[model samples]
Target: MARITIIETGHVPRKYRERHGSFPDMFARMVRAADPQSTFDIVSIPDGDALPDPRQVQAILITGAAAGVYDGLDWIAPLEEFVRTAHANRTPMVGVCFGHQLIAQALGGTVRKSDKGWGIGRHVYQVTPNNGVVAGEQLAVACSHQDQVIEAPGDARTILSSDFTPHAGLLYANGTTLSVQPHPEFDADFAHVCCELREGSAPDAVVATAKASLAEPLDSAKLGAAITRFLTRR
Candidate 1:
C-alpha cells in the first residue's frame, strides 16, 4: 500500500462541511476508489500543522485553497519552499487548483488572477497524447477558481489544456511532479454547492452557467484513477 501525504490548505464552508467533508477527506475517498489499499496522512496548513519532510513521504498531494498564490500569506512562502525541496528530491507529487498555481509559482512560472474571469463548474480539457498520466482525448472535471497559471514553468509541459485554461495541467521535467487546475476530488453535489456559493461573488450569468454545466457527466473518477496510478507507479 502506498502511503500518501495530503497537504490541506483550505476548508469547506461550515454548512457544506457536514455533507461534503474536508478536502483531504474527499481526496482520500477519490484515491482509495482507484487504489483500495492506499493510505493517507493529512497535514492541514491552515490548521497550523507543520509540513512533513518531503524525503520521508512516499508521495505528496497538495489540495486546493481559497487563498491565491500571490496572497503573501506567512505560510505561503514556506509551502512554496517545501514544494521546491520536494521537487528537487524527486518525490512524487501532485497538486490541484491552488496547489497547481502554487507549484507553478514556486518553480519558474507566473500565476495571477486572470482577466478571462472565473472558471467554475465542469470544464473540458484537451489531453495531450502520450502524457503518461491520463489516457484520453478529453477530460471534463470540476473547477472553481479565478486565479490561473498565466505562464508555465520552463521545464513543465502542458498535458491538459482548454481555451479558458491554457495551462490546466502541467507535467514537470522531473517526471515525478504533476499539477492540474481542476478538482477531480469534488463530486457533483459539492461542485453544485460551490457554484451556489459563488452566486454573490461571481457574475450571475457565470454562476448559472456553472450550475447548469454540472448537469452533464463528469470524468472525475477517471482522473482520480489516473492520479492514483501516477502516485503509486514504480
Candidate 2:
C-alpha cells in the first residue's frame, strides 16, 4: 500500500463537520477515490500533534486551513520548517490551498492576501505543459480563498493558473513537491455548502455567484488522479 501522511492544519466548522466531516477526512476520501490502494496517517499539527519523520511515509500531503501563512500563528513557523525538511529529504509532497501557500512561503516564495478579493466556487485554470501534472489544457476545481501565492519560489514551475489566480499551481524544480491553490478534494456539493457557510463573512453577491457556479462540472477527479500519479510515479 502507498502510505501517505496528511498534515492537518485546521478543521471544518462544527456545523459542516457533522455532514462532510473534517478537512483531513475529506482529503483522505478524495485520495482513496483516485487510488484505492492508498493508506493514510493523519497528524493534526495544529492541535499539538507532532510531526512525523518524513522518511517514514511514501509521501506527505498538507491540507488546506482557514489560516494564512503570514498569520504569525505559533504553528505556522514549525510547519514551514517541516516543509523544508521534507524538501531537503527529497520526499514526495503535495499541498492544497493553504498548504500550497505555506510551501511557497517556506521555500523562499511570497504569499499574501490578494487584493482581488475572494475567489470561490469552481474556477477554471489554464494548465501549463509539465510532462503530465495537468491532464488537459483547462481544469476546473473548487476554490475558497483570498490569500494566494503571489510569488512562486525561483525553482518552482507553475503548472496551472487562471486570470483570477495567476500562480494557481506550483511544482518545485526538485521534482518532489506539487501544490495547487484550488481544492481537488472538494466536490461541487461540498463546495456549495462551504459557500453557504461563508455567507456571513463573504459578500452576498460573491456567495450567490459561487452558488450559481456550482452547476458546472468540476474536474476534481482529474486533478486527484494527477496527484496520485505524482505520489506514486517512478
Candidate 3:
C-alpha cells in the first residue's frame, strides 16, 4: 500500500459548503478505487504550506479548482515549486485541470485566459496518435475552465487533445507525471451540481450521459489505472 497526499485547490467559501461532498470527495474515490489499501489524506493547502515530504507520499494528486493557474494567487507559486521538485525526485504525480495547467507552467509552459470563454459541459477528448496516459480511443469528459495551456512544457508531451483545448492531457517522463484538463472525478449529481455551479444548461442527452457515469463510477477505474501506471513505471 502506498500513501498518497492530495493537495486541495478548491476554496470552500460560504457560498458552497455543507454536507455536500466536496472536490476532495471525488479525488478520494478515484484513489481508493485505484489502490484499495492506499493511504489518503486531504489538506487544504491554499496557503502552500511547504509540500509534504516526498518520502512519505508515493504519489500526489492535485485536484481541480475554480481558479486558473495564472491567477497570481499567493499559493500557486510555491505549489508549482513543489510540483517541479516532486517531478525531479521521481514521485508519481497526477494533476487535474488547474493542476494540469500548473504542471505545464511550472515546467516553462504557457497558460493564458482563453478568449473562447469557459469550456463548460460534456465535451469529447481525442487520445494522442500514440500515448499511454489516456489509453483509450476517445473519452467523453466533463470540462469547465477558462484558462488553457497554449504550449506544453519543455519536458512534457501532449497525450490527449481536443479542438477546444489543444493540450487536453500531458504525459511526462514515460508515466511519472500526468495531467488532464477534464474533470473525470465528476459523477451525475455532482456533474449537475458543477453544471449549475457554472450556470451551464443541462440538456437531455448530456444529463443522461452524466447520470450514467454517476451510477457507475468509471472515473475511479480510470484513476486506478493511472495510479498503477505511475507507480509501476520503470
Model 1 Cα shift for residue 232 (angstroms) = 1.2
Model 1 lDDT on a 0 to 1 scale? 0.95
Count backbone overlaps in model 3. 1
- What stretches of model 2 exceed 4 Å from their correct place? none
Candidate 3: list runs displaced more than 4 Å.
12-20, 47-50, 200-224, 227-234
lDDT per residue, candidate 1, 99-162, as tens digits? 9999999998999999989899999999999998999899999999999999999999999999
- TM-score for each predicted model, relative to the true structure: 0.99, 0.96, 0.83
User: In order, what lDDT does every prediction score?
Assistant: 0.95, 0.89, 0.73
Candidate 3 lDDT over residue span 1-234, tens digit each:
676678888764435445446677776666666666767777667645556775567788888887878888888888898888888887888888888999889988999987766676666777776675546666777776778999898778887789989998888964588888887776545555665554444355544554444443334356446645565344
| Model 1 stretches astray by more than 4 angstroms | none
Top model by TM-score, which number? Answer: 1
Worst 10-residue lDDT window, candidate 3: 211-220
CA RMSD of all predictions: 0.6, 1.1, 3.8
Sort by lDDT, top down from the best = 1, 2, 3
> How big is the positional error of residue 187 in model 3, measured in Å on the Cα after superposition?
0.7
Weakest ten-residue segment in model 1 by summed lDDT: 11-20
